[model samples]
Target chain A: MLKNITLGQYFPGNSLIHRIDARFKLILTALFIAMVFCAKTPAGYGLIAAFLIFVVADSRIPPRLILKSLRSILIFIVFTAVLNVFFTKGETVLFSWRFLTVSREGIVFAVSMVLRIVFLIVGTSMLTYTTSPILLTDAIEALFSPLKKLRFPVHELAMMMSIALRFIPTLIEETDKIMSAQKSRGADFESGNLFRRVKSFIPLLIPLFVSAFRRADELATAMESRCYRGGDGRTRYRVMRSAARDWVALGAAAALTAGVVVLRIFGL
Target chain B: MEILRAEHITHIYSPKTPFEQKALDDVSFSVSPGELVGVIGHTGSGKSTLISHFNGLLRPTSGKVFVEGEDIWAQPKQIRRFRFRVGLVFQFPEYQLFEETVEKDIAFGPKNMGLSAEETAERVREAARSVGLDESLLEKSPFELSGGQKRRVAIAGVIAMRPRLLVLDEPAAGLDPRGRDEIFDTVRAYLASGENAAVVVSHSMDDVARTASRIVVLDRGRVALEGSPAEVFSHRDVIESTGLRLPFVTRVMHRLRDRGFAADVSVRDLDEAADALLRLKGGGGRA
Candidate 1:
């Protein structure tokens, strides 16, 4: 059951989108999110929706999956939209009930807020879906490269982050095996009252922690054996460079931003 | 007389997902009381899935597990008790050790059974002695133990529950030849007691041949062969089809028989093979 939980997991592929620089996709996703928020009119929102659909279709990733990842947070989205629709002080009262009044401006604000959240998640997911996690970490290090000038310990921070991300799947696999082992020994994790439920976690947690530390020790020894000194003078195997397609893609994004601005200014 | 019965059990992992696997498909088998059955299969042949269903660790997709003629799933609330009745020591169970001391760790299963402290302690000692763990070592942390010792402690943890039906999945995995012998000896001792039955799931044909009275071969979650060790070993063609080989001792006897020597191909254990050879030649020469 735990193994099936693949929310936001990267799928390996060799499409053009997957081949693009991870750094480029990260920046583009950020720009796309900003553009979605800047849009207000119906046509602008429609374009943002179309852009998300286009990206998903182009990447050959099913849109339903991107939506499926949002399943757990559906309540949060609904809560936010409902809170905005009712609490925001607006002028145009479209309808009035006993204790609830629906305002046109409030509805618009709610719709835009919901759209902003939807686009934010979908747009960010593109960076993850198209790029492998290792490439994504490398891009993050490159993005934070300037922080090294201020002696921000960028190497160590990024290394930790990358290790953490790398171990998520491995730890998940370990947890599955441990859970099964515990269950076989009659570690009753599924039943009982509140106290019993909490008590049930002892078997799972202790062994998991033990193996996690053991794995960490082994990994550190392996790294040391490989002579893995930190990023003092590391040279790159794959250097990031701006390509023709990359430049064209960035320029197209800038043009789209300008178009959205023009449309907003003209109230289209 | 069926102690544990799995009726037409089918199981699928990650159902409907891209990574979905039909682990077991309509597999059915039963073990009678006082029987030591060896379950043999490849790594992903659904052997683990089949064992897990015996105690309701996993419910089959379309079948039933009846322990003593009562469906294990009939009263889901009593599943924990069912677990005590049919103890499952998972593959490489050393990964599940948690308590501060070896004694406490070994007592985990019986403690879960809600046994009194004195009773749990006695069971723990019995289990520890059965697995050859010394009294002094029982006070040490499991983390302070060697790999084989920790694995033995883990096995003891399950054994302390004094289950009527004990199931061990690859209990000898990661152990050296000596450690493997110790585990097989302990299992044989448990069976020799006559009140307890066991199911040993293993990939090593030698281990199964030495310890099990009856043998069961699983391929893709279905029972490919089921009978006494001699009966099952006779189906060499079907066993090879599942990508399993006969034990070296069995093969040696088969080769001898094929060479027109007066030898019995029905022997499963090395001792029996040696005895049969000695009967034919009247000497204990290492052939």
Candidate 2:
């Protein structure tokens, strides 16, 4: 039942976005998110929206999959929208009921807040969708290499990230198996009171933790047996390099940021 | 009478997605009371998927499963009851052990059935004895047991439920010879006591050859062959083509038959093969 999670899932493709360097994609996504918050007018939001729509289309990831990720945060989005709509003060009130006022500016703030969140999620999902987990962590390691001189274990952190990414599906599968095994023994995880339901999960959780610890120990031993001491003197089989298309993508991102800044200043 | 039946069951995983796969396609089988049925297939041949349907653990995409003449899915909420009636011991069941003591672990199923503590303990003790678990070890935590002991405790957990139809997926996998023998012997004794039935999913022909009253071979999500051990092993070409290995004794018998000894290649056990050779020699055939 946990299979529907698409948070870190990657879709294999040969699209232009998929071919961009992982480092560039990460930078572009950050820049896109910054531009989203900087926009101050309908036209500016529309501009950023149009650019995002194009990027989504160019990435070639199915719209249904991108929308699936939004399901997890739907409640948060609604909460943010409601808070912005009722709390923001304005001179022009749109409605008032029992001292609960909804102002015109409040409505605009809510709409913009919702749009920015949705856009931010979709824009960031595009990066994960286009780039494999290993490459994404490799990019993070490369971008954070300067911190290593300050004693930050950048490579180890990246290795941990990749390992965690690698096991998400495996652990999910193990959970499914354990759930079935327990169910066969007449352990009911569904159809109980709130307290009873929480209590029922005890059977499932104990086994899951045991298996996870077992896997971690085996992995550590396997790595040690292979003489894996540390990141020093180690070389990666696949190295990241930027190409012409990556440069063009980075240039487009910079232009988008600059354009959003200008639009915010000029109220376009 | 048929104890459990899957009628033209078809299971599709992740339907309506790019990753959709037809794990089982129009596969059908039935187990008679007191019958021991062995399900053999190559990996991805739908062996695991097929057994998951027996107890309503998996809902069929386009077919139905009946437990003793009633459609199991007729009342979805009551599927939990069917689990007690059709106990399943999954592969590597040892990993599912979590109870503080072996006795409590075995009594888990009975407790779920809401049985009284006295009755639950009785069932747990009986199951432990049947599985050859030492009575002294019942007080210890399952985590403190050896690998084989842990596996037996997990199996006993289901056996304590006293299901009419017990389904196991590779129960003897990853075990030493003695461990495998003890597990199968426990299952054999369980079936011998009454009209209870079992379906053991395995890839090991030797284990099935010595135990199963019938065999079902699956290939690419379809029932490729189904018959008694002798009847199924006789079709060597079909079995080999499906990527299933025949019992070592059966293979040796086949080689003897090829050498013009006029021996029966349908033998599934060492004793039967020896007897077949002795019979041929007594008839003055070439050794």
The whole-model lDDT of each prediction reads: 0.85, 0.92
- Clash-forming residue pairs, model 1: none
At residue A1, what lDDT does model 2 achieve? 68
TM-score of chain B of 2: 0.98
Worst 10 residues of 1 chain B by lDDT: B278-287
Which candidate should be chosen as best, given lDDT against the real structure?
2
TM-score list, all predictions: 0.92, 0.95
Model 1 Cα lDDT, one tens digit per residue, A1-268:
6877774479777776777788888788778977987898888888778877777887887767787877767898999999888877789998877878779888999988888888887788788888878788888899999999998888778788889888998889888888877776678787789999998898999989988998999999999999889889988887888677777777777777777777788889
Off by over 4 Å in 2: A94-98, B256-261, B281-287
Off by over 4 Å in 1: A233-244, B251-287
lDDT value, residue A265 of candidate 2? 95
DockQ of each: 0.68, 0.84
Candidate 2 per-residue lDDT over residues B1-287, each given as its tens digit? 68898889999989999889999999989999889999999998999999999988899999999998989999988888899989999999999988899998898899999999999999999999989999999999999999999999999999999999988899999999999999999889989976999999998899999999999999999999999999999999999999998999999988888887788888878888889889988897774
The lowest-lDDT stretch of 10 consecutive residues in candidate 2 chain A is A1-10
Q: CAPRI band of model 2?
A: high
